[model samples]
Target: MQTIQTDVAIIGAGSAGLPAYRAAKAAGVSALLIEGGPHGTTCARVGCMPSKLLIAAAEAAHAAAHTAPFGVHVDGVIRIDGREVMQRVKSERDRLVGFVIDSVNSIPSGDKLSGYARFIDNGLLEVGGHTLVRARSIVIATGSSPVIPPQYRALGDRAIVNDDVFEWSDLPRKIAVVGAGVIGIELGQALAHLGVDVTVIGARGRVGPLTDPVIKAYAEQTFRKSFRFEARATVESVVREGDEVHIGFRNEAGALIHDTFDYVLVTAGRKPNFDRLALENTSLVLDDQGVPVYDPLTLQAGKHPVFIAGDANGVLPLLHEAADEGRAAGANAARFPHVTPLIRRAPISVLFSDPGIAMVGARHGDLKPGTFATGEVSFEDQGRSRVMLKNTGLMHVYVDRQSRQFLGAEWIGPDAEHIAHLLAWALQMKLTVDTMLEMPFYHPVVEEGLRTALRNAVAALQAAELQAA
Candidate 1:
């Protein structure tokens, strides 16, 4: 076996790994990047980019067919070519993947290793019996993989994950998506808009990432009107009969429903790729979820020289979070024993569904009772929303009752992606509800709804103050 020594070793050359490698190199340390699989990132390969491409196609079809309100008439049926839709998705997906591969290829050939690595001991790695690396520090940026429930295993070829969706040459006629999280809702609704029979099943009455009960319920109701959405579902059996998959479940209303679909798409969740790393050989402390107990600020795993980042850390799995975590971990690993904590940005999440869903700063469940007041707005009556014929949405802005500062928000509304960013900035800046109301609001725009929500919050705060007095 070949023996090598490096200052830092980064496992998995995906989103987090690439940035970690760069940050360590920038810190004037010799770094090695190892990959056991494809070089493309989850976002570029199967997560964000391709999913958005598919959603774009879905949006186009939906727009064309639903223009009757604007008095625009299409005499004939609007036809969508499944082949063409998939062709664009695959073509654009490959282009995005190619760019990432190019970036990976630019690394010095000697610094890149093509093998899965396991910890033989703290800071010691064994790579496929071909190489033994002794590193002063290591960063685990190994990303994650789809978690397939045991029940779905019986479906055989009829069951698939998000990674398998972009590879299809043609879209299926019917698909039942299990788990109504971000991935499931985005894809399920997109497929439904594309003329497929889609049913999205959720458990525990959750929908997307919204924790606010009102917003969650509103989102559930709105989506059900668009497609068959079973919130708070209890799935009983999953079986494969020849080419089709049969699913039986009790929905929210306690109705036992049986359905057959061409495929069962599993979007339950993802598992971090740390289990294969032989962590027992290392002295890092792990949590109940089997993830390393790392400091979020420093990305350091306990008292060890190992750092965990990205989806491997099992904390925020989004691409931006992965990049930030990777950079922090790599820099800290390079300057071991003198690690610095990162000043993390305010939390923000968005789902690119129709009437986009977004959560910024703290979640609704995280707020302390008697410490917060909420402001709400309904787009159904908002001027610009009605004019655009996209007047279906609900938003709630949370504020500190005492300090009157913006705390967080949950939203399902038009232009939420943009509005969420504004809210996130307000949270990071610690802006007050009164202060946000002072910001300029343009007339006849979606953003006007935000102003309305803020004003509503101000009124609520006053009402609470009066009752207290």
Candidate 2:
């Protein structure tokens, strides 16, 4: 068995692990990065990049088909070649994955270990069966994997997960999507637009990461138009019948429903990948869900030299959050024994569905009614939305009633991702509602919709003050 020594050892080389390795090296610490899976991060391979590529193709096909509304009639029928689409998506996805792989290869061959790492003892790790890594500090950034229920697993090849969905050379003509979260909704809608008969089922009545009731309602209305959606649904069973899969579920009203499809895609959620890491060998204590209890600010695991970052922390699963957490964890790990406090970025989440959904900072339910005021604008008739023919959905901004500080926002509208970033930056900078309202809003732009929501928040606050007096 080969023995290796390093100042810091990073497990998983995905989004978080890579950054941690770089940060530790930048801190003048000898770092060893170990990865068991493919070199490309989840985002580049199966999560974000390929999904968006599929969505973009779906959007183009949908747009070409709907050009009649713009008085641009096509003489021939527009078609989507599923095989070609998937092939192109794979080609481009591989290109992006290659970049990350190249970056990993650039590291000294001796410093990179290609294997699964398990904790043997504090600051000691066993890699793949051969190499033993002894380090002063460790960073666990193993990330997460899709959660597959026993029922779905029983169906085997009949049911697919996000990872399998992207690799398919040809998509089924009809499919059932379980769990109306980010993955389900995005892929469900895109598939529907791409000429597939898609039915989406959600255990909860809401879709995406929506917590704001107003935004949730708007999202439901907007998305239901593109695909068949059933919420508050409970899957009873899944069975394979010849070439198709039959799914049984109970609707919100207690009515049993059954459907047969070419395939079933499960996107319930993701679980941390630390189960294989033998964390018990370390001093870290895991919660009931098998997540390490760590400080969000420092990403440290208790008082030990071990640190947790990215999806492994099970806090925020977004790509950007994972990267930031990795950097902090690496820096802290490199500087262990002499700790430095770090502040994490404000939370931001986006679902890349048409009339996208985004949540920035505090959610609507998190705010106390009387202490916080809300402002809203409906995109149903917003100029830009109307011009783009996506004139549906709403935007809501929450502010502190007294200080009028921007607390957070949730929206379902055209370019919600971009709009959410604007609000995220404002909230991070502690911009007040008044200052946001005073900023100039461009004409015929989606930002005007945000400006209107800010104005509404201010008005609501003033009205509340009048009522109190």
Candidate 3:
């Protein structure tokens, strides 16, 4: 058995783990990154990068086909080569992975070992072939895995999850996407645009159910025009018969209707990957869902010299949130006096569906009875969205009616990701609603949509007061 020593041992090399490795090195701490698979985070590998590439290719093909309606006529048939699309997706994934490896190797500190990382006890990690690595502090950044329902496990390759969806050499002739969450809706729409007969099945009452109602409605409308969508359908089971995968759903009449597809893509949400890790051997406590429980401020797991970040902590599941938590964990692990951290600001979430969905701070449901005000603006008011034919989206702002401080912001529209950042920063800096109104934002741009949303919030707040009087 080989024995290794480090100041900090980081498990998982995804978004959170990689950043933690860098943070530890920057603080002059000896760190070791333990990854179960090849380098690169989910965003760089299967989750974000490949999915977005597939969407981009699909959108391009759709655009080319419709170019004739826009007065651009081409004599030839616009075709989609699924094999070629997968090749591009794989190439991009490989390039990004290579870049990450090169950067990590160049660091000249902290080594990466490819293997499953498990906790032998507090502050000790067992990795690849009986190699034991001990550190003064351990950071668990093990990400999450797709949640596969028991009924669909047998379908395996025929009915795949996001992890193996892009591995196909050719896209399916028809695909049934289960769970109309962000991934399912986006990929289903993209596949439909690429000429695949795609059907999106939402087990919930509506698509994008975790999102704001306004965003959810807009997404449903957009998806309706692109592919077949069924909401509030409960899936009983999935069966693979011959070359076709059949999904059974209970309709409103309580009768099961089976729909068959060449393939089935399941986006039923993801579960933490910590099950393989022997966390029971350590002092670390896990929640009922098998995720580590950590102090939201310090991200510490109990009194043990171990920290949790990323999906493992289950604090925030998004990639950016994982990276932020990782940065904080790594820096604190390397700190001398035993560190404690404060929540810097609220977390933000962004979805990459057509017209996108971005949210920062809290939602209306998260608020209690208080002197609060809500505001919204439509993308119809934005020149950029209007020109891009993306007028179906909306921007929402929440503020304290009395203090006028910015509370939160949510948008589902063009450039929502970029706009959310500014809103998040403003909220964190304690910028008031009046301050945002006075700020200068470029006209004829998508960014200006936020300003309009803020204005609406103010007006709506005043209107509510007038009604009360």
What 10-residue stretch in candidate 3 is worst by lDDT? 203-212
CA lDDT of each prediction against the hidden true structure: 0.93, 0.89, 0.79
Off by over 4 Å in 1: none
Q: Rank the candidates by TM-score, best first.
A: 1, 2, 3
Q: Can you give the TM-score per candidate against the true fold?
A: 0.99, 0.98, 0.92
Candidate maximizing lDDT: 1
- Clashes per candidate (backbone, < 3 Å): 0, 0, 1
Instruction: Write candidate 3's Cα lDDT for 1-469 as tens digits.
Output: 8889999888888889988888888999888888777776777778888888888998788778766545789787887888998889888878877877786677554376778977787767788767899888888888888888877779967878887877878888899888888789779888898889998888655566335666566667766888988866888878888988878888656788888898888888887787878888887677787666778888877776677888876666877778888888898888734776846556677777666777888775576645688888888757778776666687778898778889886667888778878988888888888888888887678877888888888897788789889
lDDT (Cα, tens digit) per residue for candidate 1, span 60-151:
99999989989999889899899999999999999999999999999999899999999999989998779999999999999999999999
Candidate 2 per-residue lDDT, tens place, 184-236, comes to 99999999999999999997787888988777877887788999898688888
Q: State how far residue 53 of model 1 sits from its true place (Å).
A: 0.3
Cα misplacement distance, residue 410 of candidate 1 (Å) = 0.3
